[model samples]
Target: MTTIKQDTDIPRTLQGLDDDRSSVRLRAALAAGTTPDARFVDKLIERSAIEPEFFVRDMLTWALTRHPVSLTLPALLRELRSQGAQARSQALHTLSKIGDRQAWPSITRALLSDGDDDVARSAWRAAVILVPEGEEAGLAAVLATQLGRGERETQLSLSRALVELGDAVMPALRAASTASDRRVRAHALATERLLHDPDAGFEFAIEEAKRVVALGGSGQEG
Candidate 1:
């Protein structure tokens, strides 16, 4: 918990990030963010890619956001191409927190539909936050392709992302509500329900959708 002030403290702070104990790493990440030094940016990003502890990785992301976007953007964008899943997921998460539209181009289709659930969830979050105006529909269409993917948590992430697009996602949701895959139809219906009524919980909406789909309905009122 030492305070970071002098230039000499930089190297120690950098080393603390890689310390064996998670507490040391946590304090190091906190110090990096507190000081907001450009020198700490790269190291913070690198640690974010592999940090095992969720809290520490979150702190690492906070530290990255503390730096100039110009310094952090390129490095984070490079992380998207990393072979590591955590690397990609953490970078996307940081980008979403940064909320800079300039990072939108990096939210590629591949990332949106990434094979890894965590990576794809992160990408969905980043995409919704960074998607530019006049492109929500296209983004929603692409997001629709992911309906019925993964378990409940993953499905909820996709639903939330689609719901965030507002009315622009309606067409895609409607189309998916009739997909040959019942899971896709159920997910789409659940998402559409969430879109119209935000208070409807995902569990409730999805269970209702499943019933409707089972009865050969699309949850679309004719």
Candidate 2:
């Protein structure tokens, strides 16, 4: 393969994405999106998986969104099966941004409950976006299984995804509230609180739930 030197030539755009400097790579991603080139689609998806910088990864997502879904969608779906967690996570993130319902089937329960927290969080957000109509309840039940799975940020992501499913998640939340595990019960209570009071902060709800659970209570009271 011919090496793409760092220059203004359009042919070197893919190489620009791999530039040693973060700024150049950022601009390369930005330019790819601005131009919406099919030739750049594969390069962008490739870069997204390993991009160390958060902002650049975001821009790569934006670039993928700019391309035709017919092209980007298949590439992203393939990435979901990749052994690399970041590849799966970034692909899920891009798919969520794309908002293509066709990608819904790929958001498997395994991905939602992935051992890697970042991949799981990304899967949660993507699943909420790609869940088919009338399947919210089922998705909620699946998501509910992951209660108390991670730290505050991960729990918050799960809560927000469940909240996005609306009343469909209530049954799962109620069941989880009575779980033998205090962590699961607390998270469930906090999620229920957020559902009833959208204005409530997750931290406040979680802390309150913890207090209630500490008292050997169910934490289901209003």
Candidate 3:
């Protein structure tokens, strides 16, 4: 049932990924993923780095995930070193989705604490996903350093990442809860609360932590 449209789909789809309109690019990414061709891999990674729209970039990541890891892993690891922040963030996001442990070694401390909040957030997510066995404590320690680093969204991302490491993060959270910076202490307490009660929403945990910090409590109250 191959029609002329089927025959032409490959070239048209590749070109569509670069179309001026984002909708076109989005469809192009979808098409590329729907029927993956190795030819689409490099172009997908390139476009993911510069794609302005979040949805489009997300589609691009989805498309990359559709490809084989052997094809995607090296390119993604190289992207971790890319000078562009979006490239690094997108690569980390994509790698997290891939869930390939082989990519674990590339998740370095510098990326975990990247100056850019988005990059750091993506790194935190990827690190949690890719962290090797027996490494959770070390990873948690590094993640704790970013406690209270940015705005609410960034702090929430950090807290969730720490919480994902499970009880292995307790020592780090305990140390951070006693830090001189009130913001860090509050964030640590909030993260500890989430670790204990997963159902407690971040907003409530953080507000309650703020109250504890205000009262000079580390939230380890008996």
Candidate 4:
């Protein structure tokens, strides 16, 4: 168990960033994120340039993840505007992990025009998961559009997210099972029993229950 020490000295932690060893600087960024100070937020953004290590930058993301996602997302979006692909990629991966639906609109905008297929798929999936509860039709529309354009992995991710969306997704799920692509239809069928069989839902509800001593709890053995 790696217990993080509350770094009482800010100057000392900053000095660690200057160490000749890259690992030392990475650990410093990781520790600084957990600090009670907001100033470290600016420092992380600055170090984003001076630090050449991807792992270090990823650690910086992990540190930023500690803050309220609202504060970090706008900055990450700005990073996406730059020509540097690594920063844009790392930012998207970070946003996806935070999993906040509040960023759905931005994710949707990214998916709508992103030239890269992977980035579009990731943002599309994130948008589906983030849409507010009252917005199933909207979620389904976006999801269906993505399914229409997506590769196998994107469709699978959409299917799983739809399963989480529950009954609100049945209409779309039913439609997906009828898509022109056999692969899409097959993925839709993976979730079919839940839509048609009420007993299937009940079985899943207590799937972890102990083996029945007698089927249907009968008074007599079978």
Output the number of the TM-score-best candidate.
1
In angstroms, the error of model 4 at 39 is 4.6
Candidates in order have lDDT scores of 0.95, 0.92, 0.95, 0.59
What would the TM-scores of all predictions be?
Answer: 0.97, 0.94, 0.95, 0.59
For model 3, where is the 10-residue window of minimal lDDT?
A: 1-10
Give one digit per residue, the lDDT tens place, for model 4 in 27-75: 8887777663465655665566456787887787677778766677777
Off by over 4 Å in 4: 1-22, 36-39, 42-58, 68-70, 80-86, 96-102, 109-118, 148-155, 191-222
> Across residues 143-205, which tens digit of lDDT does each residue of candidate 3 receive?
999998999999999999999999999999999999999999999999999999999989999
> Per-residue lDDT tens digits of candidate 2, residues 48-163?
88999999999999989999999999999999999999999999999999999999999999999999999999999999999988999999999999999889999999999999
lDDT tens digits, residue span 179-219, model 1: 99999999999999999899999999999999999999987
lDDT, candidate 3, at 21: 100
lDDT of 1: 0.95
Better of 2 and 3 by lDDT: 3
Better-scoring candidate (TM-score), 1 or 2: 1
- Model 3 backbone overlap count: 0
Candidate 2 error regions (>4 Å) = 1-8
